[model samples]
Target: MDQDLNVVRGDSPDWRPPNKLLGQYLLSRLKLHGDRIIQAYPQYNETVTAAVVAERAVRYAATLQSLGVGCGDRVVVCCGIHPHYSSLLLGTICCGAACATLNNKFDSGDLRRLMEIIQPKVVFSMSDAVPQLQPALSQLATIPKLIVLDDEDTWKWFINNKIAYHEPQGIDPYTNVAAIMCSSGTSGLPKAVQITQANLFTSLMAFKHKDAYVQADDIVVITSPLFWVTALLYSLASMDHGVLLVLEFGASEEHVLGVIQQQKATVLFTASNFALSIAKQPSLNSYDFSRLRIVIATGTAMAMDTQILVENFFGASVVQLYGMTEILIATGMTRKGQRILGSVGLLVPTMKLKIVDPNTGISQGCGKVGELLFKGPQVSPGYLNNPEATAATFDAEGWVHSGDIGYADSDGNIFVTGRIKDIMKYRGHHVSPIELESILLSHPEVLEAAVIGVPHPTDVEHPRAYVVLKPGASVTADSLAELVASQVAEHKWLHGGVCFVNSLPKSPTGKIIRSELRYLTES
Candidate 1:
């Protein structure tokens, strides 16, 4: 406690490692502000302080140890957003165990597949989820001990009924797998990404930078599911900073806005769609959002106009962040720094970024569209239980392929164009669907849009678009195509044509399901 526990100690947005393990760092903060409210759950009307979280985490860690969970063992957590879930995650890591977070919304088949890969030593879930998880847990070659959260007997058995508490075990910060996060699996099957203790601690340190710093009085609201990397890391960072954290439990935009008004939240993190919904709220002006200092847009890219509109609507700086499950956060816009209109902002100090030619695997200079590659401590060790995937994605030189195509400006600000796999070819020229989709979203009548490449005889693959219009707003495909044609190059135009739809498929984090779009177009 006597030592300066600030994860970062610098004036700029540069990270300085605190030389402490993530669990060590989190527990060390208990020396200060132990009685201060650390987390608030409006859905349950529950509030917990730093002292209680630390105590619960330690007790849970001891409980896991008693269940034969040791260093490097896997513990699967399948539950919705709850304080107990956070406690379980921290406790699992504190006991030198790897916590594999399962998406609570996953179907039985997906659950079974992930469990088979994780082969967790112990499985924890809410009582409601136990029914579905039972069969999946049984399918595992080794049946894991199931712990249901909603049962009072669970607490009595794990905490209240226990007499002697086992001591928490220490972990190797660099080698210990603190958590296993699941990839989005938009392109293929979901793989478990192994995140090391050092990876998470480095991610936490990235927040201590000047423009992204969290003050002790800051109230941070997180609406994204805890399974998503963005929300999970932000919650941990807020707790590490001894700041108030609010878990909104996947609430509606209106409900979230109410919580922000009531809690006087200073920082908010949500997906672009949620931000868009908040922006489009007719009664948005009635809310007291003056206390907000920054609203971060992540999970997917926000349209340039939408970002500006949200910033103006909230009277707060709206910044875009770029990162994936493999990497915690690579680029972010600063509250007080220069924010480019369509860029994800300056690269973090912890990682190195390069744009490489997709076909030749050669590094491209600035302003060239190429596959983005990242190398740093924040990058996950590799995919768990799949050496082939680990080898396929990570190169021998240690660079992890991001599968994204984007270029950086002279100032090091990144402009994400589109996914490498999502690129379209027309007339032997490359086209990025995001450029066209962004144009469509800018239209006043369109609420959302997705673009993909469809097969063509001469053009090989031509651009096709699917658009969702705002309620009662009618727009013809010919008119939308004309609008896009007027704004883009001939080759980039929608040669494969356009279609109007009620809605586009989306992942849980709000990213467009391009594969589904491709399927629909092909069909």
Candidate 2:
């Protein structure tokens, strides 16, 4: 062995080896604890062992290979709240194929549009989602090979009849594509982000070694759907570390608390909205959350007050992570450092982050807000088949122009201000809707809030606020408007007035649909 290898294998204080392939690493953990419970789906009462999961994944890979899915072929997997979805993802990765996970909640028209855009070679849909998928499938020019999951009757027949058995071929980790995740595409059409095996492995390595929030003995509760990037990474990390994954379908406070209490989950990865909901639960104190160590909030920013309440309730700091489908989880605040509120912490060890002026493309100094750019192994190579959009987003030097606008402090902590495109220009002054929305959410009577910019008859453009009040907590529009005016500058003040609504429209991932809000205002 080489001297470096010898040091890594040896018990040295400063020697540490890097993690390589995710599948091999996870499989080795399965070999150690073959019988231990790895995945639990409460709705179905299905508990899967690490060994069973690996075997099923291998078999599924064989099935995909028979259908002509090989390296670089895109296989779109539309998943619901099924335990088998994770297995399907693993199987696709093992076969060296990229799995594009579609949101199950999309209507037929939207689904068809995405299918036409991606042009996947194969698709895997649950038996329950078939009714909704049929119309979309009919519209595709070249229909993908359909694989039905959770149909025991048909699956049993295939297994019993001695179908063709094939072995899973090992793949080169450095060059193979692993998965494709769609961005929300709030500005325009959703884009398919092609995440390679190296990208996935790099993010997992950072989470394991550099982040050090997750451990092999930790029990992780997965409250978000596997279709999303954050939830998928949590499961992959847990499996890679030989930890237990307790998954719940919905984000209901009651269901989440029950699973956490029953499983004694030590870690949780969820959206900020879900965490806020859990914090606001009337009976939150009833659950024993002392066993919890880490609470990771992504998808949206957590309110400062809500974060404090949740930390006090669980005795754990709520770590805020900044990530997207393009780069997975890039920046995260540690529990110990979370005391510095409103910051997303430093960039990951292997990653490089920069804030550049959107128009000039010049790097900005500390505290100067600009578009965030990232370059690293965790960043996706490009959008699949959309070279125009890919080239536009990724520069010649390989930096990903993340539409998000933020400034890094002198200490290297990143604070995401808002999306550059989402910034409302009122009388030539730029205003971030996130800033306005955050102040609105700070109001004790407001449960949720969203802000949008609409074309104004007199001012060219103006800000509007939509709020969902706390149950039974009454507040009039004038009062709400005054509250916002008191917090913001003259140009940043709401010109369109406050509007009370039962609920604001949200994307499948729980982000407020600002375009829809503008549409509502225009109508």
RMSD of each: 4.8, 5.4
Note the residue pairs that clash in candidate 1: none
Worst 10 residues of 2 by lDDT: 4-13
In model 1, the Cα lDDT at residue 192 comes to 93
Worst 10 residues of 1 by lDDT: 1-10
Q: Estimate each model's TM-score.
A: 0.93, 0.89
Task: Supply the global lDDT for candidate 1.
Answer: 0.79
* lDDT of each candidate versus the true structure: 0.79, 0.74
Best by lDDT: 1
Q: Against the true structure, whose TM-score is highest? A: 1
Once fitted onto the true fold, the runs of candidate 2 whose alpha carbons sit more than 4 angstroms away are 1-22, 117-121, 139-142, 157-171, 281-284, 303-306, 312-315, 333-339
